[model samples]
Target: MSTQKPIRKAVFPVAGLGTRFLPATKAIPKELLPIVDRPLIQYAVDEAREAGIEQMIFVTGRGKTAIVEHFDIAYELETTMEERGKDLAVLDPTRATPGDIITVRQQVPLGLGHAIWCARAIVGDEPFAIMLPDELMVGEPGCMKQMVDAYEAVGGNLISVLEVPHDEVSSYGVIDPGEADGALTEVRGLVEKPPADEAPSNKIISGRYILQPEVMRTLETQGKGAGGEIQLTDAMARMIGTQPFHAVTFAGNRYDCGSKTGFVEATLALALERADMGSEIREIAQRLLRD
Candidate 1:
């Protein structure tokens, strides 16, 4: 969509300690947990690939090696499939082609900003995309693609904006809209995790982003903001007048796959959408809901 400054690289911040989903997450990285048939991080990677992202930069902590492996071809399985002449379609979507991925370690459990900063060498002076795997956005044209279209129109920094209920404002980075032209909004400012009643607006920032390289410099100085951790919003807020920042309200259904309820919803929704799983999923969902 953005022919001018086509986004080539994407940064995935997968270093957070998923303390919220403990025990199950004790041995496994939260990003590796399956949402329907594919892992949560796979959904993010697929979204990036669809949007023409060539270099996949993942900022992972310890025990996230599985994520790197997920994007690699299972040599043994692939050889078997080729020999048996199996419909390659059965292969997992998570397996990306060779040389498509690069990983950086976020040794400290700092925060999202720090995690992203870890990939500075890889991103190096270019407009890049950021996709949080926890936010599984489902739609016709994927969320990042929609943002790329909007970015082409207003080239600065673009972030996905969705209207959440007033009470839910505290759970997200809220935006103050300057001007609204359909789905695109001129972002006046952003406040991270403000109290529900103190929030400026109901519109919240989703995980999808198309950010300028300059913001990384701002992040370098941003020691902490809301939670005593390097805050990406803090840096983005500084780029207000300097860079043209806007919020794109894309048409999509987003699920918070980090939470149990949201994960279950995504599982059911994705399963029901699949041709093979639709009938059984519908029957099970209907029976469960009826009871």
Candidate 2:
């Protein structure tokens, strides 16, 4: 039997009140924001689906029900489309079979750690993946798929890491890398939002993580860290030495849709890739540049 434990469930912590996007986010969850035509949450869920995750555990907060509804059957809409012969294929991405998706309320906005901890009841004792919908990762095989492949080979915790500019390291949780062999880097330590100069390495932790269940137990008592919230990195940091910890360098572009700049960039980048609108969007960009 393969020593690697199967990662059947993926947790999506979408409870954060997206303050950065202001009035736009005041009504809609940030995860519902579009990257091209698809909502940001769709990308994350689609990535998890591609990675063979059978169940989606959404740690949601109030007003975040839309994220769950997005994956549900749109009976009226689908019936109308079918009756009109409008081709229901476009609605395919929005539908999820019953029992495949589940949600638990994170009634409070504690932190990412707390948001993840809220899903503990469903996670049980198996290894699971966490995908931050705000961090939209784009790759041919999908970021989660890449991590799943690595997890099967190593059979321990695996996090996606991206080599960013040193100056940008302080804004992220960076790894104290022990050794690197190709795309996999051994994680010695993790410092969340350290000063740029004090950072151990520029390889910052991205959104995707395949973590052991023990980390949930560690988070049960994890003290607040950085910005006075229960930081997930703090919990994962404490679990570093107890088991295998490594970072997989993501072979893809990561767009931080959590911020305005990153969100706009992601929108334009993905929009420019569309078959029907690529030329039109490019021309608009060219016109704006000329004016």
Query: What C-alpha lDDT, on a 0 to 100 scale, does residue 141 get in candidate 1?
Result: 92
- What tens digits encode model 1's per-residue C-alpha lDDT throughout 189-257? 999889998998999999998999998888888877667788788888899989898999979999998
What Cα-based lDDT does every candidate model obtain? Answer: 0.88, 0.91
What is the alpha-carbon lDDT for the whole of candidate 1?
0.88
Candidate 1 residue 166 Cα shift, in angstroms, is 1.8
- Give lDDT tens digits, candidate 2, residues 34-93: 888799998998899999999999998889988988888888998888898899888787
Off by over 4 Å in 2: none
TM-score of 1: 0.94
Error of 1 at 105 (Å): 0.8
All-Cα superposition RMSD per candidate: 1.8, 1.1
Q: Which pairs of residues have clashing backbones in candidate 1?
A: none
Off by over 4 Å in 1: 1-3, 82-85
